[model samples]
Target chain A: MGGDVIDFYFDFASPYAYLAAGRVDGLSQRVGRPVRWRPILLGAVFKISGGQPNLNKPLQGDYLRLDVPRCARLWEIPLHQPLPSPFPSLAASRAFYWLDQVGGEHSPAALARAVFQAHWAEGRDMALPENVLDVAASLGLERDAVEAGIAQSQVKDRLRAETEAAIARGVFGAPFFFIGHEPFWGADRMDQMEDWLQRGGW
Target chain B: MGGDVIDFYFDFASPYAYLAAGRVDGLSQRVGRPVRWRPILLGAVFKISGGQPNLNKPLQGDYLRLDVPRCARLWEIPLHQPLPSPFPSLAASRAFYWLDQVGGEHSPAALARAVFQAHWAEGRDMALPENVLDVAASLGLERDAVEAGIAQSQVKDRLRAETEAAIARGVFGAPFFFIGHEPFWGADRMDQMEDWLQRGGW
Candidate 1:
């Protein structure tokens, strides 16, 4: 809390979070502060905040069609559009929790990327155990570890706690940030994010 | 379009637009550009884009209650908060169209403030016909003229056409600006709005 660190609150299902994740590392280095990734569930945030599920909107399906490709092209990231929304995010959330627990050479960032790719790049459903395992293996993580983590109660509990923390702190959406208690909500605010954190969030 | 003029697409329903409406004069003067008011119905824009009805979102209502006061206090603007949800925007849009019709004094800025205040301060429903007339009367415009304009078929048609033009220009939401062929959305982008309009929108 003291030395210049920005806690980046993220949700895996968020395209904006996916966009910000790719940039946070470089931003952190340039701003001379480290970013701590706090994984939170977006669905819960939306429910409490009264935010609509984008997929449920009248143009739900088409939004990602325009937004995803446009952002991917801008950031030059590879994206695989899922045919059916890549399924429940529970497993992907568990895998990241397990990855976070073990404290291996794998950065949360690597696991995060792999999970995004599982749903977004490979167009694979996250609900499928095989899909989760495939993405885990691809990230050089052992499938056994992921399976054990998913089966454990701690994974679900951890995610619930994270979501609760986000709600308690007034984070109503994904890619929301608290640069020293000031909430900035939206992807377009990244430049302000950089400036905010760079100036120690004045 | 060929001059230093920039089209200001505004919605009486949007508080940010209200903020912009009042401040744009000074912003234009500082940035050395002329801003032309172009009012469009936000309801139509929301229909095509993936935005929810105001009553549908809890945080929106919450933000309206909590954030508006703070924003007005910070920005030193008169924000009347009792306005009905989605305050009768049709007439508000129509009124701006009327202002454009009469070729007004005060540069359409008063109409802009009335629109903002109708929704944010007086709690007037901008979508309501009565509220539009009331706002116009407050601005010293003849009540009959404002109401007569709203009844005009051509004015209504023009309003609809502007909304369609907004959609056609890739505008997905409220408070949009056009710097040449490029369109920027939201009051959040005001800084960027100034930057682009000045630099020929490079």
Candidate 2:
């Protein structure tokens, strides 16, 4: 069996990504592949791809408003509604890279999960740096270290580079996965991804 | 079981809709629901919804080029690649409405399937009215009647009105389905649609 790590690209601001975050780990375990969680800024990716968020579109925005919650209920994931206005995903994304770089008692994945839950499940506004820090602190991460790490030029640059790299790699949307060289986009595509992984491509 | 016909909104221009066309009948049979096929022009829908075709976008276009064939393989559907440049879906679409109006020995659904197969399975250029008529003729549909029906102002107006109605009903994409009041979009959402039909929503 090929043991290539599945690269999961996501933005915390995306509710679909939040829904996908809950279940990707289980898929990884089932397929016996380690997941590399890569948080990216969709805003940057969109600027290049000339794409807009579903919430910004007309009919699609309406459909997303309905679909997200229904999917949450069906998937049995707890999700709070009406996310913070101008949902701030930047701070959380930066914090993720910082946590990843720090590599301490808490894995970056845990912080990512906690941040997704705090923002999506508990309706916390991730726009505030303190809110992101608060979620990190809840995970026993050093509050000062996290704040410092996120502010560091290296961490900021890491996020910028990663987002650019994601765009370069043709990732235009959240909850995108790369099982080997094959790319699957959207939370709904997980089933197809699993099938591809198991069948080794048809 | 409450008998409600599933409204399937599609555009012949969309490859995803073509893929959905092959399976929707089977789904309808399995769920004990009749399907009302409604073909709308996506070009009009996109104008109102502020949407662009996946093929027009950057990263998404590349991904779709790869994903379409992969999905065809996974679904075991025979699909010909490199679709006709500027795929003439309008002719086939108009012809479909014409066929529906002049219902005789052949069902409109049969014409839809044949048109999809000719365009997608055989890589026939649907831009030509002759090609669309030829497909209809192969299906035992009267050629001259179909040509005359498509030319009628009433048939043109019917297609226009249907496209307008689709937008009013919030159909922004191809292969959109309505199970009662619940709306599901995309060819990939078939499993969810089936589950909703069988489980009567969660």
Candidate 3:
């Protein structure tokens, strides 16, 4: 994941993650750089940090609900919350790592976009294993193999190792990016990140 | 506080607050609008929200420590962490509201800048009452009156009420701004806020 690549870490269930997902690739293409899509489980990171998701908070929850749509409108992206939002993202993460092994390098990025759209743009449930396989199949990945891949021990271990590595690297939130050791947090920092990429950091 | 005025909320003890304090006025001037500088105590708001300062968090603390200086350099602002960082901001907040009463419309803004500079730029300990009085004296205010002003029950009550009002308005963090009730959180959202002001909100 080194050598002029943007290590983009995100969780499928995060609305802000989806927002960044929509832009990270285009930004990469514009800069003539490749983006390595690293999907991490925010729940496990939150457990270690003793923090809770914004959807569970009181005043923050309402403001975030409003802000997400505002951001979508401003960025000109389609966004709609799923029926059971704040849902488990493990199935989506497991599918991603499985694709990373069987499918080509670009497959994970394509599948990540579809999964994010399924949960964030189309308002489809991502917690179900069936929904995850449908997203992979649409990307032209085999259906039965993708289904079997989710339950494989190697896929589970890969996701676990990636999340732990993220925690060890001090990544406590979603949509976190590493531009060659300089960490940029939050979707709001996208402009700053682009400036850094173009200007070669300050 | 209404009618095309941007309500800018901040705490003197917050480094991120200092960053926004430096930019909000310039953005307002460029957009041909006014800003009401509302100094708030984040500790009180944290008490209600079950949140703590970033300095206490594990990963967040380290990332913030790096991000603050990076932001400062990028903005080309002079910044130096004061001795006894995270110093008490009561004296500064009380001085602000008192000046808001006795002084003219621009007096509070001038004093807020001085207090922020004293703590964040000049590396002075704002926790000391003397340091706060010195800041007020530099602004041509009566020193003895400013000294006594910090101890007044009414001044303390004003800061408390403003903080509670901020919480009621869904302000959960420092450097929060409102372009006529459209809430924007974080100093990074400064660009979006300016765009909203220029385009008359999306």
Best DockQ among the predictions, by candidate number: 2
lDDT of 1 by residue, B75-169 (tens): 56676644345554777777777677778573466777666765766666666677778878877888998889878998889899988987777
lDDT of 3 by residue, A65-84 (tens): 76787777677778885323
What is the C-alpha lDDT profile of model 2 across A1-202, one tens digit per residue?
Answer: 2358989999988999998999899888998888999999988888887777888876788888778877777777898866433375878888899888877677889889998898889888888899999998998888998888888999999999999988877788888888767789988878777877778764
Q: What's the TM-score of chain B for every model shown?
A: 0.81, 0.95, 0.94
Candidate No. with top TM-score: 2
Worst 10 residues of 2 chain B by lDDT: B81-90
Chain A alone, TM-score for each of the models? 0.86, 0.95, 0.94
Candidate lDDT scores, in order, read 0.69, 0.84, 0.84
What does each candidate score in C-alpha RMSD? 6.0, 2.1, 2.4
* Candidate 3 off by > 4 Å: A1-3, A81-84, B81-84, B104-106
Q: Tell me the DockQ of each model, to 2 decimals.
A: 0.20, 0.61, 0.57
Instruction: Give the interface RMSD values of the models in order.
Output: 5.6, 1.5, 1.7
**Model 2 segments more than 4 A misplaced:** A1-3, A82-86, B1-3, B82-86
